[model samples]
Target: MGILLRHIFILIIIGCSLSVTVIKTGWSEDLLFFTEQYPPYNFTGPNGKVSGISTEIVQEIMKRTGFAYRLKLTPWKRAYELTLSQKNTCLFTTGRTTERENLFKWITPLTENPIVLFARPTSTIKIMQLSDLSEYRIGGYLGDAAVDYLVTRNIPVETVRDDKLNVRKLQGGRIDLWVTGEMAGQALADKTGHDIKKIFTLTAIAGGIACNLHLSNLITTRLQQELNTLYQEGFIDRIYQKYNPDLPVPVYKTK
Candidate 1:
């Protein structure tokens, strides 16, 4: 009986050790990050590696939290779908909205991304408010929050898979207005060699990191705390300065 009890105690010790190991390593194993080719926020470099403002912020969060992850630069639609359906998955640079508020656990307000409507230089379109866009066909990218916002407002919009196509469509007069972020629109315009001018500001929204519902609250909480620390310590400010020296650092509100 003594030997049996000793064996049972040893087994208990082993089990506890295994549990601790699993707890330590399981968070990293379960987390997968998804992003897209939205420049200045999340995009691929010439070497095919993910790097951008949002990516840098997320990397700092991960580094501080000690969470290991694999980030993939995927199509926006696929990345959004995977984050919606998969467990322990996260997507960055996601716009936080009322419709998407309850869908996932959000760690938010990473950076300011004001949505704007742009048009060709010689176009004679006047848009003073959101209601003025009803008569025009706006071009946007698929799986973008701006597209969803327009649809919700019953605005007419044509969506394509690539944002660069929207710039071309606007240039060719295929679409009256191109809806995109201020910074993003400039980047796409520069890339496509099109000089598009902003017509109206639809809304000013900050982007965030959205995690799957199945992700542990503990992990999310730690990440949120670390992000808050980043903001408080001006680490995020330095990152923004590295990307856009002329612009002010974005202030993210903690949830």
Candidate 2:
């Protein structure tokens, strides 16, 4: 199920009544958004609609800021390409990296994601340093920052289009290691109904939300400030608890 780039110019004027509609005071049909299934963060619903913690946060910003936007679930590469080529388009739940820092005029920050490395529990491999696992095969998703971060260093790693496949493959003894977020990996682990603890290891790493460079500086500044505000107000932490009640997440700190 691939969502290709189609410029749907349909106006989705939301949060407005007839009285406000007549005045036409607030409007900015200038935003396009994209996402992919990176579960616990973003995922497709049973009804095939987009909904997750990240989506919820983005929706909140939309409601508060009145940024006219469209969300699409597509292959990461496609979404990234669209965001790069099309002005006013933004991709979310992207890792903040040195390579991509200058590319997108980021919306400061939107949410928090902790980058991590996971492994089957029974595996004898214990990693204290990234170089320690260089001799073994590592599995990561295509277009995922981990793959790019590792592959660029000439490390031996495999790329899978779907991260779930990596977990399944790891559980089946097809791979020696898999890298992903602890939260999402655990969610998939549970969804698969497998005792993953007997099956994975997790390493704490960096992840967050970013937008395309096309966004205005004002939006970027406001976005960052709002993230701080949301955290201070306990909104993000509440969202995390709603999605994950028990386990701890690096990004969701206690107030």
Candidate 3:
């Protein structure tokens, strides 16, 4: 009986020690990084590996921080939900909005995207302001920030699970306007061979890594600082230029 009690005590000590080690490591086992298939930002490459501008930047950050992570490409809605519910989970290319300000710990801005209203070349719609879009049939992607923005303003939006479908909807005259990132829309149009044109720029968004609120402030601060350094040292510019050589790099400001 004495020997069995001693062994049980030893096991308890070992378990406690492992718990402390995990706590000190910040991420449990490995960090969970989630993203969707947004081309030019993050998408599966020809080799089946996740590759894109934002993916490269995130890879560099992980390399610099010496952190082990598991990257998964999932639906944006599932990724967003996991980031909100799980600890030490992160979702990338998330737009920073006033409504979402306190929901997650924002690490760093990965890209600056102009949210625009797109219409078919032959469409006769014109959007001078937010209110002007109310009359038109607006198509938005599910779990996108643009949809929430429109909904909050009392504008009716037709949401689909896949953003690519919006392009088809607009082309077929199913929806009058498509709200999405300008570059994202262009990339989709290029892929589908559609001639979608930007109708108006709704707003410019700084999208970045949004970690679960349970994430340690220390880890978030460290990442933010490292990303700022990368931007200032022009490493971010180099990565962006590699993917978009024809376009001028936008200046990144750390907030």
Candidate 4:
């Protein structure tokens, strides 16, 4: 009886060790994802799962490269933290910025998005340079990079919880300019009854899929290489066209 009991205990230990090994290997684990709506990028579908350009790219990366992952859409700040905190975690369509460079291992050149400054039709503000933004009050997404750039350079600005509110405030004559992603701005302007027009194209911002720094470089490079191959084959463009019919997909190259 004692011998049988000891053998059973050994079997349980062996089984538990294999389970831990499999989970750690990412072969038997459901990986975690972090994202926010940067649109035509990541967002929640009507069925409450992930759906967007970022989601599409990530799905292909997982399928083609055999990485297992699942996505969760949350606000940007929390998504950023969650992605940075977990193993086998990633955030998508995220702007590859100097501020966040060290926080994640990158799979970059995902998409090129234009960040622009917008103004109401009634306003005739012309922006020739970033410095010109200081002339009037500006509004944008609370944690948006443009606002961060301006504020870091000592340019005074206002932040709204989201871009929709910025349009409303602009329409209400509360702000002279708003910074936003061009694709999103155009779509949003068309959707909402706002007479927002681009003051100037700020710059072409590069966004990508990134994993927490704790994730192995092997995993990061695997996805990056697969995406590069997809880009060369024009598959990324095929996915982008699904989100916005008129959008012109940019060519990807590694620096």
Winning model by TM-score: 1
lDDT (0-100) at residue 84 of candidate 2? Answer: 82
Q: Kindly list the per-residue Cα lDDT of model 1 for residues 1-255, writing each as its tens digit.
A: 999999999999999999888777658574789999888888888787899888998998998888878898889999999999998899999998888889889887687788888999998999887888878889999978888888899886899999999999999999999988889888989988999999888887768899999887888888889889988888888888888875435666655
Alpha-carbon error at 165 in model 2, in Å?
A: 1.5
User: What lDDT score belongs to each candidate, Candidate 1 first?
Assistant: 0.86, 0.69, 0.87, 0.77
What are the per-residue Cα lDDT tens digits for candidate 2 across 1-255?
123222232222343455466444323455677888878778998888998887888878777776667888888888888888876677877776777878776643444445566767766776777678777777888877766767767776788777778888888888877776666777787788755542233333345555666556666666666666777787877887888776454454432
Model 4, C-alpha of 180: deviation from truth (Å):
1.3
| Of candidates 4 and 1, the better by lDDT | 1
TM of each candidate vs. truth: 0.89, 0.77, 0.88, 0.83
Q: Write the per-residue lDDT of candidate 3 for residues 167-214, one digit (tens) a residue.
A: 999999999999998888889989999998888998877888999999
Query: Which candidate model has the greater lDDT, 1 or 2?
Result: 1
Q: Is candidate 2 or candidate 4 better by TM-score?
A: 4
Q: After superposition, how far is residue 252 of candidate 2 from its true place, in Å?
A: 9.4
Q: What residue pairs are clashing in model 1?
A: none
Model 4: residues >4 Å from true position, as ranges?
1-28, 45-49
The TM-score between candidate 1 and the true structure equals 0.89
Q: For model 4, what is the error of residue 109's alpha carbon versus the real structure, in angstroms, after optimal superposition?
A: 1.5
Task: Report the Cα lDDT for candidate 2.
Answer: 0.69
In candidate 4, list every pair of residues with a backbone clash.
none
After TM-score superposition, what is the CA distance of residue 167 in candidate 4 from its true location, in Å? 1.5
